[model samples]
Target: MADQLLLKVRTDFVERVTKPVISGLLDDLLDQKVLQLDEVDEVQDRYTVRADKARCLIDTVRLKGTKASQIFIDSLKKRDGTLAEQLGLVAQQGPPGDQLPPPEPSVGIQGQQQWIQQCSLSEYQRIRDKEGDQLPHKKDPLHPRTAESCLSLSSQIYPIHLPRETRTRRALIICNIEFEHLSWRKGAEADVGGMTELLEGLGYVVDIHCNLTSQGMAVVMKDFADRKEHCTSDSTFLVFMSHGVRAGLCGIESGDETTDILSLDTIYETFNNKNCRALLGKPKVVIIQSCRGGKVGSVLMSDSKDPAVPAPIATDSTPAGLEDDAMFEVHLESDFATLHSSTPDTASWRHPKKGSVFIQRLIEQFRNHACNSDLQEIFRKIQYSFGQFPRQLPSQERSTMLRKFYLFPGH
Candidate 1:
């Protein structure tokens, strides 16, 4: 009956709910064991818009059955008596008889957005535009990419969570273009600007650091891992752009010129489950736009005329829980996907004014397809785009994700 009551008032709830109330109710419901940690994260991180968050919160609570719904209603009554009254919710225990002051007139808290970082997605500019290239195409506005009912992957039904809109959607970018001793990564500013723009469009507050040394890179990653924002983010993207050696990224330093280097292993270890508790069980995406070695990327080219199509991805089937059970032990490190600019022991190409070919393709692929494709799929498209260009090939490695990650661009 309580669930029905909530279901009946759903539209009104969505229309009238405010951020403070949502935040407060989430804490209370979570403390009451009516909602799990991952579930709370699901509501807060998945959607960016206030109304969307409200819709999800109520639906999640109501589905838990009568007790949960009643708790939610009671919590609502205390937090915003006027709206609660409008929804016909009376504290089961009538307002105290003079023992407590009357329910104060609705704090009339004029509803306002909780997270207010304004973002304007930037344009993709390609230098020396390939005369016949289709990329860096004309810009198109990003529309919201809604999620399907369910997502099946690897014989598991890991629901590709919906991207309704949430309070915290953050991204980190470290671009090393200028160096004290090394030549400037000439067009790197283009990559920096382009990446910031595209990610902001995808609802991320891009935290950028320019010209960090190897040690500095480690510090930055450590700080980012500890940020409070991750508590409310369903997924995150960490990007590094700079010169590099086979061992790892060549932090604002060139080979043999400086001792600075941020090993690839350190980056992963810094964000692993033990180190980054805040991001545990969430999608942690990494993009590296630096050369791995001095050698050319192409090796054995296929002489056969047959086209190279990617292997077919598996379909979804089994039904899984809303989140990993709170009690069950999960893998120490999972749900991480890293894309490298060039394969190991190879060099990646870039134009002086355009930036790394990898970053440019990133801007193109994500801008064009992110609204409809999951992150993994978009990465695949990027890899394919580099197929004909024999100089370099982006490689996807160290991926441990269990679900399809949809960005839902505009929402």
Candidate 2:
């Protein structure tokens, strides 16, 4: 049964269990003879990644059956009490009579005491037999594929009290390609459509708005932040795509040198804890896919390569903005991670028929990796992708999240 419990929480445990705990667990298991010396060596030397080491350690222990598995979990309580509690180990511990196996060699009371307390629980943990490896998952839209749960992200940042029944994850996309006085952002619709599908697949009720002024953008931001849906929501994402400059993002009527902008500082304040209490401690993902300036210029790489095809035709710049300097109101904003398409004051490139290079790459990264990697990790991958392309580089402007954020797509 303990092995069953370990199996159920395998993905979560491997993701969050720290490296030090894995080493300590190995020592304890070796002391109690649950794991042979060679098995421990295999976990330590054969596995390269920390998470890999954890997976190996747990699998090795579980194969020793109920007694060894119970000891491993019990030792977890003494070694890393916080993680034990998070995994429901402390609360769901088994009966005391199911003692650990006798040590193969004589070891001190310390090793015995580590797992001896497992017998000291007031409540019995309920054990249910999972049908099979093939979990009868009837495609739930909110939690799509039976993927890794966010509990592995963090027990603190992710709310335990807010059950799935009460949650309403929401996302917003604002793409301003058809400027009133500027050139049409030729392939921006591709970005919006791709992004919408990604967010919707993650179970968010996405709200899409196109071509708005600075003031209009502010109004929508304010309304979205103040919505009642967020009261029951777990986390939110906001993506803004448009022409931009050093000052801020350009509105529909704004062009180069104009002041009609939705300043980044305004966005920070709108979602800060003081302004938006509902999202105070939750993740507020912000993605800005627009040109920061005209310095780097545009590159329009065509999808087709033919002698008759015209040269590359597009860039994301028209009117512009960039990351704003810190404002006092938003200086201590919590739980916000804002990623910009380009470095401050540089133009981000676009394929006239596809989309901005940043957005298109982001779409690829999230679709392929969101199921396993945390949001920050995925963002870093997107940033790393631009290292090969000299024209533009994406920047993670601000991150104040308290813990890791996994989209846990289809889950």
Candidate 3:
């Protein structure tokens, strides 16, 4: 009989929910001593169980459309009221069938005391108006508890909170246009203007640095990383535009010598958790607009007069730690992303008059979608835009990000 009851309930559960869910439920019921296996028939689906003393096996097995149609309704209500209510298996109170109890007439405070007593203190307070009259008790959509719950859930799901315009929004734009020996980049300065304008419009306090040597670049980056703004800000952007090779961006080394290359590894290490604790756990975006190599790409010209431009330059895990042989420490690192102008060993396109193809497309796409789309999606669109042309394809690298990062430009 117990086996028949278990088999019936299991069948109903599988039919209504899923086989996997029913399997879990069966295990839980067995573990909780609510049901015990009695016998297993030759058929895989047939099972027998011994129910608890309080639970009736006969009522628990019935699945017909009679008065006791729902099996385990009482047991489910006793085990998990919320789950029973969600599954619509809770037994109706008052009269049976589809008939519900008639609504009670409006009553005074004396008659409503029992219902008011069941409410939380804060909820009860909200029931009264400012004039102290007992107002109709309506649920508050913006209650403090509700807001806190939502925030808590969001934080758990998306650990990093992308900074808003109201917070400290800072961007560093380093454009090296003038080289002593090499021909000066024609449109490098224009790129700075466009980038700065776009960033500022998005509420960033843009700092532009022009024609810096390798040492100067390092100093500026270090200083910026240590800024108090980064400590308080939700996110930061570092944009570097100059000549470059596969190793890194080229800084001026005594005029035209490209010997002074600021290595990409060094840049990453500088902003890492250990060095730049101020920006820890916040999104750090690095945008580079420099050539990575000498390989140039072919362009398919359209009917439009715009000339096909040459490639312009471009531009963690958690672990446990022990201290003092007695204490254990844990550290987590995340939320860093880099957007490169082109793939490794490839030249990035630049327009001598307009700007680098990457930066131009970036600014346009950001303006169009920053308010609605995430940073990754916007970058993907920029890459798509370059697909029509030649040579310049953007690439992105990201560390562990708990949630999506969005600029929310113009917000």
Candidate 4:
């Protein structure tokens, strides 16, 4: 049931929003001797922080191999003054340990309180806002939660679809939101809703979701791996919208340390044939809206500056790729097709209303072209529209990766 899905989403929310604080607090306390070895051992003995810890590590993660150091710090700090002194000596002689000294006694105590409040407050508010006070655990959207699912940090990206008919292929739209909660992101909302409208009209069974976690996102793609099970036809479309750092998508959860975003590859690779079913050998289309680089080195427009409205550009339709044999070569046939509004080389684009520039352009074209031509033609048309969409002063760039996919007539 959809409510069960919502319950799963709630689990994700806890993992995303609250688990980090608990995990970090555990780390900070254990390192600072605030939490004794026995306490940690007891917690580990009962519940060793699996999902919660994994989520924290996934977000706070750095290069690699640092987690072990963190755990060592926790265990070492759990020991008495003698061990700390010995560890201090080891650190002085070798590498400094990764854990930060526990905050000043007063500060650590107060900070712990603050962390608990901050960690739980916003999520509770969000659940209350969505589910209401009386009916908190409304599992199905059809029936509101009787009590907001009390689970911490759990949330979902709702992707809805209607069963397909004979003429149309199945389509999936994935929208990722890096910033605000999924409910609050107007840009993501409109774009996903718009895609649903356009694709449904185009004779495709469209599946859509907004603001998914890395794991959740991967699961969505994996669901698409089976072409026969999910879709009646061979062709399909997939979309991704999110706040992204270069090469990655932001998970709703915070990092164990740095809070840097996770890579899109974390989710995208799920659709790879070795992993998924329905998506194998199908035309997989992906659209992304996120910054690709850090070095734009330019100031953003001031409050008084008039926004440059996006104007549609005019261009004749061209073939998907340039090479002659490339027409429908489907170069890595099982691979996916991607069209990113911002090059992995640039930062991000703007959308005060309907969503990211890439999604905005996608909706515009899908609305205009989905019904008339094949998915290949629709993509090319959308590509042209995006190339024409206006950007802020340091105009954002756009590009696509076909990865050996062909959406229309085969050569």
Candidate 5:
């Protein structure tokens, strides 16, 4: 046998292996009628017998858009159930009601009332701190919690109606060019393009940037802050594929101590801001792909149950030691660490490539799992897929910690 085996293949070859497996899974789902729904609640929560049909419906809409929603609704016309009852009620109501009451004057912009009242409370605190509580309360638009005044629930569910023209999606892709000096595995551009394509397929307008310098990254983040301030999108996502060390991701300026890399806090704060509330209470997705610090084992098992039999003890010259099917695991574990925080005398290496290993898998999962599900569903798919194909990273590989996030599930 050849000493050096070519277990690792290019993107084309990898796709070839994955396509059949995914197609079979999809076909199985379709055969089981995972796309049909008898009731409206079944559309969201799903039914046991009709789960396959529901899943199929989700898959179809993910590929074909809301036309699937209409088709599913049409399928439910025959049955006279709750949804049918509701539709009949609407039909009885007709286009115009009997001398309908005049429309209530628009509360000058939605949510403004609540915002102003909250601001007034803060102001009151400042006034009490600067002066004594003896200051007379002034009559204002916002009422104080005195015996005479109280806050009323606004009829509007949301402050602003997101215009149909405006695209409401927030996504991020952060890449670290580990060996920029060498120009080998630069995955940022591919990461951005693949992710953008996936998002757009799911009805979103995506923004992309490539090869950002450290300072450039900061500037771009500031723009995101401004978007959040203006409520550009209801949901947010952040993807980072970059060269990183044990501490965090590396910067373009590797040698300089000041520009080694930016910490996760700096990046998190930009979107997590309380004032720039565009993504508040919405799902924020973050994907990190880098080498964590750990020793590379000679062999990686592929869920094997058999005990160690008499197999040939391979040497380092050959690529036959670890049996892990995953290709992202490199033999050099600390190389990524050195890239982020280079030795004082050494130079940095940043290379460009088709895409990062983690990123490629993420895109694949998004394409497969994010069909009709919300962002959190997408994350669930991501976590499941990664569990199936574990990466060889340091023991301290970056783990996901999404704070309070709300998606289509309402939480």
Candidate 6:
């Protein structure tokens, strides 16, 4: 009998031999809905199958005396020497019409059968190793049930797919230009008009209130927070323009003798989920364009013949909550953000004819980038625009947010 020697095929040739066989098997599996292939790379002889489906394929191929492995080998044999030659596994077939020598008598049928068996084992081992690597790992610590529940709750809390309806958009814009004894804000009216136009263009139905006292401001905030419209809205904006002090925004009642103001923390708590369930899981954007302190920002002047003249200064400056009731259940608050015009203990600048430096830059930046950027990103650009001036830096505070919030202007 001829020597029973193993035919060593190149690894590349082995890979080539298994490609078509595996592809055919995958097609059958796919047709039966037994497996799903998310992605496939025919050139690399690799494909990604759904995790569960991969295990099914492995189990089916590894059965005792399984004919699937044999079927793969038989398919390769049917291709004759074409696949082998393509992968350089065997010598190239002779030119067409070239007669070959007859086989020797010692080359028995049993020897050929043994060679076929060896080839089948080689192909099976290669596939088993490759498929085994594709199996999903059991490294995740979280149980599937816990992960699924988390995903479900997250989707419910933050539904990004909901339409941006303009009719549902709401904003409370309070501009305090006239003070009882304090100097009037030169450009506060302009700030209010600009904010109204900008917010209305962005789809908000703005409620403009001029010259509100501290008590009036509190009443307005509570009423707005309790409105049913907020329940159907995706987001809301609260803009306050007035002279302010470090302690809080100065109201009309604020004067030289005593301070009449609203606490910032109180304003935040009023719109919180605990107090305002209607706005829960929705973005509440509060923008304050006012002086946060008594100091004024000044710039160095270049040498000139003109006389030095005094420049006007600007100033800064909420709070309310819901009554507890036995029948109402409290929900955790989230997704509140506050954008202050000036940093703490610093003065915000404004022009007599134009608006405050912060509001002007804010309107311009939002109009330019609102369609493409999120609210946080737009605020960053606004802050950068104020970098040229001295003592004017905007600040922001954010509560826990399940998902990013976008203004989606013009939507």
lDDT string for model 6 (1-411, tens) is 101101112223323444445456556544444444542232123213232122223323322112342332233334445763453323324532221222232212232322111223344334334423432246555644344244433242334335554347778887776677776676665676577656755656666555667777887799889888786787889998877765556676677665667667657778988888878778888998777664443442111111222132332211233443322223344677678887766677777757687888888887677655557778889888877875578988544554555554433
Query: TM-score for model 4?
Result: 0.43
| lDDT tens readout by residue for model 3, 147-188 | 324443234222333434237767888777666654466666
lDDT of 2 by residue, 39-156 (tens): 8897788655675577668766765666888899889989998997787776633464243223332111222222111211221111011111234347678756544332332343
Two-way lDDT contest, 1 vs 3, winner:
1
How well is each residue in 1-411 modelled by candidate 1, as lDDT tens digits? 565466557657877899999999999999989999998996788655676578669867865656888788877877888998887765446533222223322111121121112212331111112211322234445633223312222222122234435447668888776565655666776676677656655666677666667887898799899999788777789999887666677665544446576778788788888899988878899999876655332332211111222223243443588454533323656788999988866677767766778888988888677655667889999999998887778999988886666554444
Worst 10 residues of 3 by lDDT: 300-309
Provide the clashing-pair count of each candidate structure: 5, 9, 19, 45, 35, 6
lDDT of 4 by residue, 5-118 (tens): 121222333333344345554566566554567755533443334543432232222111234334434443343334334434123233344234432221111223221112
Off by over 4 Å in 4: 1-164, 178-186, 226-228, 254-262, 294-335, 371-377, 386-411
By summed lDDT, the worst window of 10 consecutive residues in model 2 runs over: 123-132
Q: Which ten residues in a row have the lowest lDDT in candidate 5?
A: 1-10
Per-residue lDDT, model 5, residue 177, is 39
Q: After superposition, how far is residue 317 of candidate 3 from its true place, in Å?
A: 19
By summed lDDT, the worst window of 10 consecutive residues in model 6 runs over: 1-10
Query: What local distance difference test score does each model get?
Result: 0.67, 0.69, 0.56, 0.43, 0.37, 0.56
Model 1: residue 293 alpha-carbon error in angstroms: 0.9
What does candidate 5 score on TM? 0.41
Off by over 4 Å in 5: 1-164, 176-184, 228-232, 255-259, 294-354, 372-377, 387-390, 393-411
lDDT of 1 at 220: 79
Identify the superior model by lDDT, candidate 1 or candidate 6.
Answer: 1
lDDT of 4 at 145: 45
Query: Using lDDT as the measure, which candidate wins?
Result: 2
